[model samples]
Target: MRLSTVILPIHRWAEGQKIWRRAEDLGFHAAYTYDHLSWRSFRDGPWFGAMPTLTAAASVTQRMRLGTLVTSPNFRHPVTLAKELISLDDISGGRITLGIGAGGTGFDATALGQEPWTPRERADRFAEFVPLLDRLLTEGSVSYEGDHYSAHEARNIPGCVQRPRLPFAVAATGPRGLKLVARHGQAWVTTGDPTLYENGTPEQSVEALRGQAGKLADACAALGRDVSGIEKVLLTGFTPDRGRPLTSLDAFVDFAGRHQELGFTELVIHWPIPDSDFAADEKVFERIALEAPAQLR
Candidate 1:
């Protein structure tokens, strides 16, 4: 399995650049960041824009792929996001992946002075968002209208460097969302089940993930797509076990082994932040980064 890290955009470039370069130097397959105006705990802190942070990351790192853990329709319009993604792909030399999702109700939900969408509404907007954005990246110019979005010859000239556009690591767990994944995703992302986050056991969390992966396979089958073609990514820390997996190389190997058995092709862990929700011993985290994957293999 490939290992990756999610570096929150909480540092200034002077220091952030080193983190991005270190992620590559440490051998992460990819380094992603949360795409938000301001995330939960870091809401009041110095959070940066995902695109600009990624652009800077691309300049500093040469090998590790870069992307947002997710970008959403919450405050983004497909037309404009498509343009920025194209630019990011070119700047990264085709090393960009777009992790998108049906955004949840959070600070980002109303950061734009709008009410948070009902789950149904968010799903509806996401259904509309993905395909339109897909066409925007593939075609030279797009002119279309949808229930939630529109494009008027929105030109994406000289499009993506990753011909046919960069890979999409779409995040989904529900049926409708899984359908979108089967149709457009190069990778499937999950944070396990939020309901289990606070009260569930590790075993329960694994079962929940198993069920979700089964649904994704069913979605792929219905569409006559090979499920194996899509990578399954588990973004760690939200699961019940939380930071326990990063406590040691052996702990990570065991944790990764269980999930790998369930067909997870990639595992993403947070970059340790001292005294924060993501807090962990940086040395142990680094050891997992450097040794766990090889041990798992």
Candidate 2:
């Protein structure tokens, strides 16, 4: 399985860069940041917006990839967003991977001057965005027509240099979302313990996650894609307790391992990554960075 780490930037803005450099030095596969316009507390620090920080990160890291944990479709137009992903890909020698979701929470969208989209609208917008992104990043020109966006006169000018065209993935939850992954994306990007049952039981947790992923398999079969070839990628973040006084780290690992056995390709770890600085709450960040990797193993 491929292993990667998240640069859970806490305390100061400088730490984000420091973490990226360290991730690159440690030979991690990817370095990702969350898409957060603000947070609950500790509002002060040297923070970097996901896309902007990546431009700088691209210049700094040689092998490690860079991207957002999940950027919202409302944040940018499809073609424009494609440009950003491709640009970063070129900067990183095709090491960039995109993680996006059917954006929830209108907070950032409102903050960015982009109107928030409803769930159905978000999905529809994604449907528009995906095809447009594919065309922009792959072909030289695109003529797309959709509810939220349409493009008739467009050229894939300065397109991404990657072979597969900006190796994109979508952050997915629930059955419909998972199936979407199989249908259009390179992989299914997820966060949290899919195992489900927290205060409940293992059977409950397993069943919930299984039911969700099962839908993806069904979706793949319907689309005539090889269901067995579908790659599973869960981005684990929940801090379930361990076994003993040390909290054996059982929650995240076993939760992941169950799905890993189910055939996950990669499980990128970005734990307790506050949308903003947690200088007073850096332990969550530190404990996760230092101990989470061990748990993943």
* The candidate that achieves the highest lDDT relative to the unseen native structure: 1
> Which tens-of-lDDT digit does each residue in 197-243 have in candidate 1?
89999999999999999999999999999999999999999999989
Q: Give Cα distance to truth, residue 201, candidate 1, Å.
A: 0.5
Model 1 off-target regions past 4 Å?
A: none
Cand. 1 Cα-lDDT: 0.95
Error of 1 at 185 (Å): 0.5
- Give the lowest summed-lDDT range of ten residues in model 2: 239-248
1-297, model 2: which lDDT tens digit per residue?
555666543434465567678667655567787666653352354445677777777887888778777776766677777777877787788788777777776456577766666677777777667767777788777887777887776676677777757766777766556656776788677553534425645555455556657777787887888766756666654322211111234444555567677677676664334442212234433443455556656
Per-prediction TM-score? 0.99, 0.80
Error (Å) of candidate 2 at residue 215 is: 0.8
Summing lDDT over every window of 10 consecutive residues in candidate 1, give the lowest-scoring window.
Answer: 288-297
Clash totals, every prediction: 0, 9
User: What is the alpha-carbon RMSD of candidate 1 to the true structure?
Assistant: 0.6
| Model 2 lDDT on a 0 to 1 scale | 0.64
